[model samples]
Target: MELKNRHKKCINFDLDTKELLKYFPKGTRKPYALIKEFFEKQGFDHRQYSGYISKEPISDYKLTKIIHQLSIQYIWLKNCIKEFDVSNAPQTLSLKNQIYNSIEKEENKIYNQFIQKLRYYQSKKKILNSSTKIKYEKELLNLYQKLEKNHINLDEKSLKSMREIAKTKSLKR
Candidate 1:
């Protein structure tokens, strides 16, 4: 394994549909079918990848951008899934509304807590040091994560996505 045996070669690689799902959840929550639906909804001809995409030689930089975009799309799709899904399901909208209300309530509750704590400190004339501020920001993020797990608007799709994003558990459990 000396420098005399150095190798500097890049072989051709073919991308597949699996590449599109590369950023998606890895386990049962991968939501392959749902992601496929999202691809179709976005008018991405993934099937054509086999015919044209694989045949073409993409630059390393371009391929990196493509994969990065796929990851972002996974995030965008999950966040917006409930909005579109809720619109599609009109029959039991009341239940959906309840979920939405609960989500809103949860958000407000957290916001109120933050404000109250801030005011309490202000009333005491206590200075919020840098470390405390950073800790507070992390705490806020944690609370928001918890609320969103019930999912934004408290809908099922968002909940599923949240579960996928969560490192601690999966929806399967």
Candidate 2:
């Protein structure tokens, strides 16, 4: 069977479903057949887009769960950046930006759901009362201060690499 088909209903199962199911009941299976049948009745997956499966159908609950997981991951990365020593500098910034970009590129609805949920939680719980928030903020402040200090950092490394490349080109000329 093809991994995906243009004419057949394209069932977009969670990419990580199999691994995630390990935490659930043994022999647990998602309602893949039900999803396919539902799409078939709706006349979906008839046309292809970009030579891949063209449609995505997911329940709001599942979408919320996926987004929540991603939000938690984003928060974790943010916390990591805060806790990371300034000596790590641009490497941490690069890593943080990579995570931020990945999260931003995800399905908009899912990302929005996450942001809403995060906001909801923040509203319900006072940031001042949350020890984790205080820790993250404090660490972030420290990191920012250290970053401002004279440090051989990521930008410097990139500049050095550029200079070396330019020197090599000049020698060739």
Candidate 3:
């Protein structure tokens, strides 16, 4: 500590740092390789990893509380994933199918409009002019924004997220 503080410019910690940080890993450079090494150490194929970790309840309450509170914008996607897990009823299936169709149609319409614009540009033998390029980028951004809006709907998702956060706060008290 004194050497590091005194010789801050030279920074002569190469020898002492190893002894200090020996408890914690110093190397395993890449994250992916580290993850792979961890799984391999855990014998992931043999399910030995379960023994090292505490058991969690098989309930959506925790997931909902965590994901909804922290990542409000992605509440719909998490809800959709939860819905997919145990969607058995005919009504549920029909509703999911209807939603899928609606989402598909909207996405297709946006894509088709962009395609038409591209075709118009092609038809005119234009070499991607500035205004046309701007329009292209605008269309792409519009499509992305629409999809994000669809996911974070006020009544369906964002409201639910707020309610979930409130529920957790109440529980904590």
Specify the highest-lDDT model's number: 1
TM-score of 2: 0.17
lDDT of 2 by residue, 1-173 (tens): 23232122222323234543444335333333333444444433422211112244434344345435544633422322212110111111127787867755643434344344434434554545556644433443344334335242334543453345346446656
Candidate 3 accuracy as lDDT? 0.38
**Comparing candidate 1 with candidate 2, which one achieves the higher lDDT?**
1
- Give the 10-residue window scoring lowest on summed lDDT in candidate 2: 84-93
Which runs of model 1 end up more than 4 angstroms from their true locations? Answer: 1-94, 125-173
Colliding pairs, model 1:
148-151
Number of clashing residue pairs, candidate 1: 1
- Please give the ranking of all candidate structures by lDDT, highest first, separated by commas: 1, 3, 2
Give each model a TM-score: 0.24, 0.17, 0.25
Over all chains combined, what TM-score does candidate 1 have? 0.24
- lDDT per model vs. reference: 0.43, 0.38, 0.38
- Residue pairs clashing, model 3: none
What would the per-residue lDDT of candidate 3 be over residues 1-173, giving only the tens digit for each residue? 22222210100101222332343356423322433344344332212311112122223343334334433532323322211111111121127788889988987776565456444544553477767655654554455456456562333443453345346446656
Model 1, span 1-173: residue lDDT tens: 34333222122223233443555546424454555554444333344221112223334454356445655866634333322210111121127788879978877886566455444433443476756754654554465565556543444543453344343233324
Work out candidate 2's RMSD over C-alphas: 24.9
